[model samples]
Target: MGGKVVFKEYDPDQLTFLPYKLEELVPQGHPVRIVSKVVDQVDVKPINRKYKGGGASSFHPRLMLKLLIYGYLTNTYSSRKLEEQAQQNVHFMWLLGMKKPDHNTINRFRSEKLSGVLKQFFSQIVQLLVAEGIVSLKEAVFTDGTKIESAANRYTFVWGKSIKHNKEKIKSQLDELWKYAQTLAGEERLDTSPTTFTEVNAERVKQTIASINAALAEQEDVDPKVKQKLKYAQKHWTENLKKYDQQEKLLGERNSYSKTDPDATFMRMKEDHMLNGQLKPAYNLQISTQEQFILNYSLHQTSTDYQTLPSHIDGYEALYDTLPKAVVADAGYGSDENYCILEQKGIEAYIKYNIFDKEQKEGIKDFSNDSLHYNQQENYLTCPMGQRMQHIGDGQRITTSGYVQIVSRYQAANCHNCPMRGVCHRSAGNRVVEINHSLRKHKQAAKERLNTDQGIKYRKRRPADVEPVFAQLKHNHGFRRFLLKGMSKTEVEIGLLSIAHNLRKWKA
Candidate 1:
């Protein structure tokens, strides 16, 4: 015989209604409950002042902020999804006190009202975390950067190199056209001053066009070729010249930027499922984390991690009124300029340079190359074939950051008949190498620090402190691509994500 079975009864049309309280629906120690408590403690007076007194009633800023934070915590980034959840999800309904806001209202609040004020909100939450002892400002920070793909169209990328190349071609054609016009007029009609083609901007191109028209105005019998060239220049070159000018203005120091989102630069993104190196519109997101909690974050257009360190440190200082005692980062953030900046700021740098790992291998270390053996007192380098490479000369190198680096050039005595010539260097003549003394000194100092006990501890804890935050953000939250367009809006989106991450940490 089968065991006695019991089934629970359900009636959709039952008239009995129990007294339901939203607070009782959520249990204590729930993430949503913790989010509610934390949002209640945040000071929203600055956000409140953005709204004027006379208008139709809108959702309270505090309520909207709480809704947005909770939405992100639950991995609901889209406004439409959040709107749907607000009407259906019990936790969201409880957080909003059963007040359902439409998708447009949520998006408007995020983009328009909360655009400039997210920094304050993020700081307040961090300060609260500090007060709760979840974060330590004196602890060492683990810094890293990742490219977050922008919402801009990837095909509309404008590269600085392409612009320069095309501009030169156009300038050459225009110069030839000018010479042709001069030959037709039998005199130097346009200004033939000694100016480089690089100086030929849209205004100068327009002036040249006007000069050709004025020169051709008086002549009744004009060459058909010259007239045809003039018409072609006016039709084709004017718009391109103007467009290049605008693009140059947009690309001040960046290599490339997207047209739809001008502040987002084109960077090589990690490949998709097809395994191709796809260049997409992205922003470099630099974050400093401790114990897997994001202490600070800054957005940059520069693709490299090294260039983002100084400004990132500055932003941290601006937020916390002080800097971390020590910063731990991988080799990507290590550069001569970065070391100099960290030394000036009096922060301990446990960073690694490009060749840090390569020098650790046995084969590379046993090569006995000239770069490895340098006699400071004798000012000479010993080649792999036991030849003395003498220091030939000294020179000055100006870095991109305007710091002058002193470089010493070393040339092998003779490599023409050396036994190890093919292995050491494949050049027919003596090999020449330049070493920057300033950079070498900084690298030696960094190496010494990296070998110390405290440095080892920081190194061991770095991956634990920072990498999981990115994993949680990208993998757990499914926040791979940005939903917003401009830099400011993207910053707000990141700010919300950071807040949600911290709150989730706090709850855990």
Candidate 2:
């Protein structure tokens, strides 16, 4: 059978639009009302224009503010785009009260009010969530750190101004380019024929070299105080110039250099590069969530995961009244300082250290004699060579419900003649190797978490809780790179994106 014909027009009146209200679609007692309420409380008296004669009119600050915020929540960050959508999209139309706002007006509203407005909105949301009982301060919460990729590339990276010495790399590149330019310039009877390229291109190469060298020379002459800035400028200039030169040189000979975005950086996704491995520049987004709702998110330029924990915790606590009850994190968040901080906070934290090797240094495990085991409080340890270590003077000791640490030193004389010297002693001869009293806290926690039913539930729930949110933003929402520069702006961008994600989730 043949296909049936179908036709459609862009007429609005002929369509029967469904009643899909944004306000009605959202959950009961959503923070949108709180947003409206808080915005109502902001004073617009100062913004009102006053004539010399008498009273004056005031622009609707609240309406414009609401539109801008709703725009952010919907991921319509571009002011022009927001304005276009406001006239077209039903939700945006309703939010903006069917008024056609110019793109410039929208931009001014966002740029002028975003800083203060976002903070106010965030505080109100926190307060509303607290009131709604979505957050519980009494339960244990798990925490993890993830690196946020920055909008800027590392090549744009500027460092502290230092002019101690010259680098041979720059010298080498300059020398090579100069030689190549000289060679290109000297070419006579340049081949018009593609097959017979006249005497290797020297003059072109020479010009290129001269250009690069000039940039280098300028950098070298810059004042020591301003050398860093000069270096950065030269680096960027030379790189861009080289790209142009290479493209022009290869013209039809090769494909044009395809770096359309200079802000992008190559991010390594895996430790080892396999055949099918992928690499791309992406923002490392860090998010903190509660009750399946994202509380905070931040973007950073960190390549490592170690440094994001403390600051994130601080940010969360500052934004919200209380911290999550029990902080659960992966091994990346595990550090001596973090452990100390968690303990100090009186929070039950479960951060796993990535230490898998559990081999005993010596036969110290066998040294737990009847006497040693009986008096567990004393500061003593067993040596690998079946010898007991006793503390000489006042030494520090730590104890937990699971295990006690008895740190002590072995006699150098006794360790010297031990038959199992290689395993027990790492030094040249009889030397005491101070051993930490082994505590089974980590082992016990791991075992219980993997075995117990509650632990199993938490483990299962964790990945589903946070991982999908990130996947949605990155995959569905086209939020891979940032639109702003610098850490503070990046943080704000992240916050907006997070707000957008939550709003979408709520809408869905």
Candidate 3:
């Protein structure tokens, strides 16, 4: 051993002057400080109005809001995690003022107290950005949507097709049972009137099964197969019908719904790792953004993006009491209803049709419906064969939202023995085309608006403005799946996320 060896001191338990200042513990430019500062300026009267007087002296809504917004900002969505952070993390400790509310309090505050008024709080934060000139409602509001997985079990789902098929199976079996009962004594049928199986229900099915059971009760020569079928129907069919009724009620306008979370619809997710065309229960998250800041956001049960745009714009108008001066969206949101609504609101629609880009390519529009020359005065289209196609029929199409579009059907005179017939028409008969005049006119106007210099500028900015925010939320912040269950609670979660994002950007 060497002589004169020296060692520094190490203490497991040592206490000097016990002075800890959380204010100085956190830095001046920390994001948590920004979250606390921004939320302090916004009013929470809407959330305060939700509480009734005198129930064990609750935590202040502003405090709860700060904890939640900051929690979301840091990619901590679980209430229990937020609670732990409040007790352990210095940033959270500084923001919460050393008050550690349990997970129950945090969750109840998020799910119950912040249900409806959370949107108002988000709007207030956005209004602050507007006041500071970081964003403007008059600028183009770029709308886009992405499907996020719901907080539900993926396997528990009910399909409208399956329900209808089960009912049809019941109907077919009932028809067979009735025909079998008719061969028995005719007087036994009068004991209970024959319930109509045309339009089936739980009560009707039960009545019909009862009558069949009574009719076969006294027939000693009846086939045991008939009795077995009737027994199965009595044991399972009526109850299945009742459950189907409940499921149908839950799936009002949706094609499929998750039983775990009834508000979530089955949609084809792009994040399918296996790439086998898997559908997951998810919600369509629609948001309008300006300068990468979310202006308005809405959650829809509908899977398609086109159907969600009008409602999204409506939600934006509800929040701001006015509409954006212009909207720029991708082709998914290009629909006749959307175009009409945007025109009704007097906003410039730089929306692209599904074939807007494809049709502009060389030789792509040849022999297509749009390429058919139409004389506006005569209302007849000249086909590729130079034959005049007259209108054959006109019908009305009522959209799910009750918007009516009148479709006119036109047919070519003949396609027999034409050189271009093989390429022009695929059907056996003449080429028939259906067109909506109003929809075409709207598309033409949209085309004109989308080709201008202003439209090109917005086109480039749309992806930059809206997509990075989603990328940051999903990739960086890890907000890919929701924490809450129902639409109302999940809506509040998104509102919290929006506020956190705005504040985080504002501080930056």
Candidate 4:
């Protein structure tokens, strides 16, 4: 009772000595301060140019940008939450200089004003770090990729395969109608071209349907099935073909795209909530780091990492006006196209191939063509049974991306009574093996570089340098899903995340 009676007097209305400046109140090494300092040095003229001289005044781009970046920095991703924080949080208030921007103003600024300019703004921040000795582009880049869920509906997928299937179905139906028309009106009146339905457009389909209906109109005993089928195709064939044309245009180079957000591709995400490998609408976020700071970032619709390196390097060149001297990436980026491109560009690819780990394992014997004993001078491979495989022909195949792969085919003379015939060569006749000598040469060169002392150092440094940044932003900062829709706006969201990540690293 005596201790309870000694409580200090309290008054809600009483005012005490308060700091006049927010800088004096906030700590020296706060993350908010780091974001503010980094963004303040960026030239917002690119963003400022986004707005023509308007009649109504808007918040300064610098103030809007600072709030947007600091919001992402502190895990406040929603524009509504940012507006609330700008009103209530002292750091946000100080960063905004006491100017309050509502959620609409903030979202508009982020989604529209910073649409194409955020990358430049991000590059400027990286340049400032270069100026202040915080990070470097001269260092070898550690590259990686991860899928981030798009702000698109999951069930609203438009499948390219389905589109092709339906289009072919239309062609088949049209061809069937032509045969029915020829049955009734003879071949003279219904002389349709053989290739009429092979290549079709909306207008061509409409004309063909009209011709089919006209040819059928000449008959008195046309079957009800033919008339009914012609009736439906007349109603929907042209319309369906038009929609398929639009869907194909939206697909670009992807197999599937979301109807809500046409630019987002449906990809198998590791962060699947169903845990059964469900494919979701997501973007491939490619980021490269040096000293654990994100140096460049790009978003791609492609799901695989192999198809993304060339364009990712293009983005890096766009940002810093130079390519990275060396790039270390996982085996996913290893492909014939990627290897040839890196060798062409003279960027020392510390990139591991798809078989990089398996080939290094000892004790197990591999019987693949790549493991064969090759006479380099004679361009022939010796079989395990001491039989010679002659170089027969050079076969060429092209990938979907137009990369031509030349494979040298070799055939063994005979395999009669050889003990290793079934084990080493699985063919009853003479065994034929096709080899892409260029790819093999690339793998050998990469293996040599990866086993070197410097390569060993980067091999150890890669996982530590890049994975932590992704984990920090995704797990700790809660940025796994994008807050905006469409490619341009979604890219701006990733750019902000990368900037926030680098600034937090600098603060640390």
Candidate 5:
């Protein structure tokens, strides 16, 4: 009581002044704050102008972009839902600076400027992250391709088999009918007068007309399972069926059609049933993951992973100055051309080439590690017959292993008389077989990777690091199907997905 004594009357409705510092309601350490801080470094000035000059005083481009990205992370891609969230949700409100951007604006921004603005935005974010030391280019990267179905229905497929079979049957029937008519006309001597062949001619001509009409109209019965078969057949028959009575003039033309989306293709990945369900014309989404960040993405019509390697490498190199130290991919991307591209680019790639037992099957004892035939750089195998089979062929007499495959071009006279022809030479002449020796460059690279613990460990990291990326995209991000059409549009959409993926990684 000696120091201080205070007496206060507290009223529930009375106004009172309190001393306190006004600070941000949102925490600085939140994931949203981290994302915002990272995105703040992105220069949105130029891109924002594309949606400028509007009288409605539209929402800030940077804020809208951030919110859209947030939507992607939360799996809320619907523009209407985003609009509602902006108005009601506190987190979205803060991220968007409390501007309630209409659904139309959000839709237009993504659809229109997505190709250029969003792509550059993503690149800039990646560059910023790289500069911040979050991603190490030297560590490892996994490149993979996944199928994103289109917005169209799967009922619109054009099967080559159905189309081919129908065309062949029509042609066969038309040929038989024409031959019979020609034989009857010649036997009746109808060339001279209508009366001479009139008795037989009237009935035959009517029969021929009916037969031709039936054949022409038979397209209606074309395979319903084949999307464009009916349409193609109808078009051909309507145009090419000269006069119904003129059976000789009937000419068969083969064509195909697509019902749902004309551009869609029937993709085959091993057996028929693997991708069996209904499918639309889809784009292969190619992503480059660096340190768990999807740096760049591109969409291609390539049905296989083989074709995506060159383009993905080229695109990644173009965006980020150099190629990744190691590009890991599934067996689908393993090909001679891919290896050649990686080699040319000075990129060390770890793509598995065992698609069809070309490489040893998984869990098949991994005999490759134990076998002396395992040449890292040359990708060769020592056959049971003591012949060295070219694992990676250079497509010429010279093998990739720096060994020249010497072929004994002994004349037919020499090989035909060989006593061991059945065992060594199965041909009529002396056969040439392959021989392999290690190349200096290949040996060095292989030794550096396979022989060392770091290289082997990183090589094993390929599956763990990259497979989850595709899994996340497919299961969480709704990237199983594409939202846009054409390669360019699909590219834009895929790029956004990659951007969204990288942004999420950075936030995490």
Candidate 6:
């Protein structure tokens, strides 16, 4: 033994007679201290009002809220883990005042009492942060969307496209089967009532099955082939039709949804480790951030960020009673409708259009025939080959949101004998282009704004402001998948996470 080690103290059974204070155990400026202080400041009257004075005495809403928020902050999202921490962890014991609420109580409080009030709680914490001078509502906000996996099973997916295709096939088969039945009866014995296939649903399928059964029952001497066909329709077609209808209902306005968690849409998640476009049940979590702090967040069933922008800003307005002075987002959010909305609301839009990035390349501009000079007075464009592209008739283009965009058509005078035909027009006919003047104007205005110093500053700060919060939530806190099901419960859980994030930022 090299220089016999001297132990300062060792005691397994020696116990102190003095009482220990829980508050004295936690150090100053710790994150748990911040959580306790923030929870103490939040007004829980709304949460308190939800309780009816009938059941056994329950844990105080304030105490439960603090424990849940602290648990989320520490990456202890599971109710069982939280219960264990309450009994074992000193920090949790100190936060709970040595009171250990079982996992059932913890879960019930989170799933039931905390369901609708989470938005209020989130808004209150944001107000606190605003009051503390940590963030400002008037400042520009960077908005982005990420897909978080839902608690729903990955295999129980319902695709809208598949439902539509199968429904069409089933309709064709049913029509053929009905015709065969009528021919077999020789006098149109089967009912000729036309069924509306427009909105095929389980109820409608059930009615169709009942009608077919009644019709078959009325037949005194049915042919074997006709009977076999009718029975086949009842068994095979009925089940498929019902499935398609259920899928259609679940996928109202969305491309896909999960059977377990109907609110969660199946989207291509970035978590695919094999670099394949594997679809998983997930929710679009759109968050607006300022100065690395999450100012607001929303959950959408759609994966695209464009459609979520308007609703996201609406949510922000609902929370703070006013929209931000300016909104900054990437090209995915750039659309004519969004630009129009921002303009109507008098908010500066630092958004980029689809071609905003591509236009930055010098080579692209050289071959981009659309960038050629246009004579508005003559209503024509000059091609790169010094050819006059004559004005054709105007056409209307309908957007995904049903907004009609008017585009003036233009065609090159002649491309048959041009030396630069290979470089310019590869079409057999004259080069045709459609120009939406209004959308062009919006893009031009956006381009001008995006070139400004303030716009550049917003762009530079966007990734830093919003991306890190996601990293902290997903990587640091291990919130890759939601613990709760349904949109409402997921929203509540995210609200808790956001509150924890803001509290941590405040502590920092």
Which candidate, 2 or 6, would have the higher lDDT against the true structure? 6
The residue pairs in collision within model 4 are none
Candidate 1: segments with Cα more than 4 A from true spot: 1-6, 188-198, 213-226, 363-393, 398-404, 412-422, 426-430
Number of backbone-clashing residue pairs for each candidate, in the order shown: 0, 22, 0, 0, 2, 0
* Candidate 4: tens digits of C-alpha lDDT, residues 339-441: 8998887789898997788777862265777777889899899887778999999989897677999999999988777777778866678889999998989
Q: How well is each residue in 327-389 modelled by candidate 2, as lDDT tens digits?
A: 665666655455555666766555555541122123224333211322257655555554656
Once model 1 is optimally superposed onto the true structure by TM-score, how far is the C-alpha of residue 152 displaced, in angstroms? 1.3
Q: Write the per-residue lDDT of candidate 5 for residues 1-508, one digit (tens) a residue.
A: 3978777977778764863222255666665666667668888876666765747676666777787777776777778998998898777777877678889988877777565656777778888777889986555677777676666565565554554454456555444444443443442322222222212222444444454334434344433433244345344544433322232221122122234534444343221244665444566677777666786687665467777677777877777677687776766775556666678787776655543233233532322222224445655544334344454234345433233433221122234454545655455444443322323234334444543676567667766766688888887666576555555556656666676777778767
**Between candidates 3 and 4, the lDDT winner:** 3
Angstrom error at residue 389, model 6: 3.9
The list of candidate 3 runs beyond 4 A from truth reads 1-14, 191-196
Clashes counted in candidate 2 amount to 22
Model 5 earns a TM-score of 0.64
Candidate 4: which stretches are off by over 4 Å? Answer: 1-5, 16-23, 363-366
Positional deviation of residue 128's Cα in model 1 after best superposition, in angstroms: 2.3
Predict model 2's lDDT versus the native.
0.51
Candidate 3 has a TM-score of: 0.95
Candidate 2, residue 273: how far the Cα is off, in Å: 12
Best by TM-score: 4
Best by lDDT: 3
Q: Tens digit of lDDT per residue, candidate 3, span 231-338? A: 889999889999999999999988999989999999988777789888888999999999899999999999889999888888889998988999999999888999
lDDT of 1 by residue, 1-508 (tens): 9999998998878775776788888888989888888889888888888888988998999899999999999899999999999999889999999999999999999998898888888988999989988888877899998889999987898999998887898788777766666776756555664333545777777778777777677777888877787788778787887898889899988889999999999988763644688789999999999889999999998898998999999999988898899999999988888998999998999998888767656324544342558889999987776788899999997755566778899998778877766667776689887887667888888888988998889888998889889989988889989999998999999999999999998888
- For model 5, the superposed segments whose C-alpha errors exceed 4 Å read 1-25, 45-57, 160-281, 355-454, 476-479
Model 3 worst lDDT run, 10 consecutive residues:
187-196
Query: TM-score for every candidate vs. truth?
Result: 0.91, 0.57, 0.95, 0.96, 0.64, 0.91
Selected candidate, larger TM-score, 2 vs 6: 6
User: Ranking under lDDT, best-scoring first?
Assistant: 3, 4, 1, 6, 5, 2
What lDDT, from 0 to 1, does candidate 6 have?
Answer: 0.84
